[model samples]
Target: MALPVLVLAVRWVMMIMGSDPRAVGLSAEPIDYTINYLGLWAIRFLILSLAITPLRTWARWSWLAPLRRPLGLWAFACALLHLSVYFLLDQLGSFSLLWESVAKHPFILLGMAAFTLLLPLALTSTRGAIRRIGARRWQALHRLVYLAAIFTAIHFILRVKGFQPEPWIYAGVAAVLLLVRALPTAWVRRA
Candidate 1:
């Protein structure tokens, strides 16, 4: 599952390790590509993570239920890597540059806000944490993932110019996932 991200990291490192990095093709284009790739994977895993409840409740796929935690964790990991690549490689590890980006591009702030929301959820995802926080409270708190996904959708939309179907499709998927989760489970059950 993590091997693709590992491979991407290795390729990114290899491309940027030398002084003549541009000669080796370490340029804005590849950085943008990598950033896009990371963001896509983050969104993908996030949707998958959010889908488990609906699947378990409506489809009664108890066997697939255990995957929820791991999927959410991977979503967080990919999102973190997405932020890291932007902050580290794209901005050259400059906080000022990042802030400047936030000022210049609203999407950066949206992305950061999404990440901020995910932090607590990631921190308290464990069984022990749930025990400490109480399952009801933990479940309530984890619902923040919906807000995070919304912010991510806006960020993605702003990142692109004019109109594109891709970001909107992801946003629509996020919306449908939320809708399904909100539905009365007793009203609809399929075998």
Candidate 2:
């Protein structure tokens, strides 16, 4: 699905590098723009994955149920790429540089933490792991997705700074999706 996006990105980069006469801004390569685009897409996928359960239950679309895991895995893939670009290309794979980034940039630090948590979820998403651990336990472990979403929102908000509308929009959407699951159970228990 993302292959076309990658191809378009490559073409855009080539155009930006001024190899093509018809290209615009054909001089400066906007690395930051590319990274931000990937990050936002990953975040959007995460949001969509989070929405699956609610959509299934409320809309009674059982077909939507199967997409959640794959969507999450895709989110993890994009996140890995996003972090790789930042850490390898942006920070040059230097431990000292990454440490400095962690110390100096709260947003980057938050993003790193979020990505770290996601690694285990991505690894153990297999049917074998789920069966070995038992479904109930696996479900409990996967609840880490909520925390991951929270951390991701923090990363996004920190990245944008100063109440940017887009981060807030994503945060709002995530909050609603999470609340859809939480509110019903809380209500049932209270009642």
Candidate 3:
């Protein structure tokens, strides 16, 4: 948590300081880099949160269960930041431009779809909300994360102009995580 926050802060500071010799590549297009950085962290955190269940099941480490909530929240936070950068910096708070981008870019639409799905999960992350929803219902609702992850990966892959290994790698990671979740408990245990 602290690490992510610290990295975000440093990135923000570097973006502001633009033209620093050390920040060459990032300084050239700070907003774009910041957006990408935030999105990457969001995906990484989402994957980490999803991994908690499998880790707990395989390692028998119950303590890891408590971490799922925070990781999920962090993913949402990073996603929010990513959207903010796009809206505020890239789109200049123009709804017309935003709508145009959404219409013109399939990746933007996919990213928006992923964020929409994440909203409910983030809102229901609280213990009180979980209790109100009932455990079974809450679990079912949270299963939307798989769809969100898929959308996110597609959004990422489609955004790049040329073939890049980074986006593909993230998509691959998402695929593996989803596969792990889809596997039967007995099958997982036998492995």
lDDT of each: 0.85, 0.81, 0.87
Give every collision pair in model 3: none
Each candidate's clash count = 0, 0, 0
**Which stretches of candidate 2 lie above 4 Å from their native place?**
3-5, 12-27, 185-191
Candidate order by TM-score, highest to lowest? Answer: 3, 1, 2
Task: Flag regions of model 3 displaced more than 4 Å.
Answer: 14-25
For model 1, the superposed segments whose C-alpha errors exceed 4 Å read: 13-28
lDDT of 2 by residue, 24-84 (tens): 3323445575577668877888999999887767666779988998889888988988887
Report residue 147 deviation for candidate 1 (angstroms). Answer: 0.3
For lDDT, candidate 1 versus 2, the one ahead is 1
TM-score of each: 0.87, 0.85, 0.90
- Candidate 1, after superposition: displacement of residue 39 in Å? 0.8
lDDT (C-alpha) at residue 77 in model 3:
94
- The root-mean-square deviation over C-alpha atoms between each candidate and the true structure, in angstroms, is 2.9, 3.5, 2.1
Which candidate ranks first by lDDT, i.e. highest? 3
lDDT, residue 123, candidate 2: 92
- CA lDDT, candidate 2, residue 130: 98
Q: Which ten residues in a row have the lowest lDDT in candidate 1?
A: 18-27
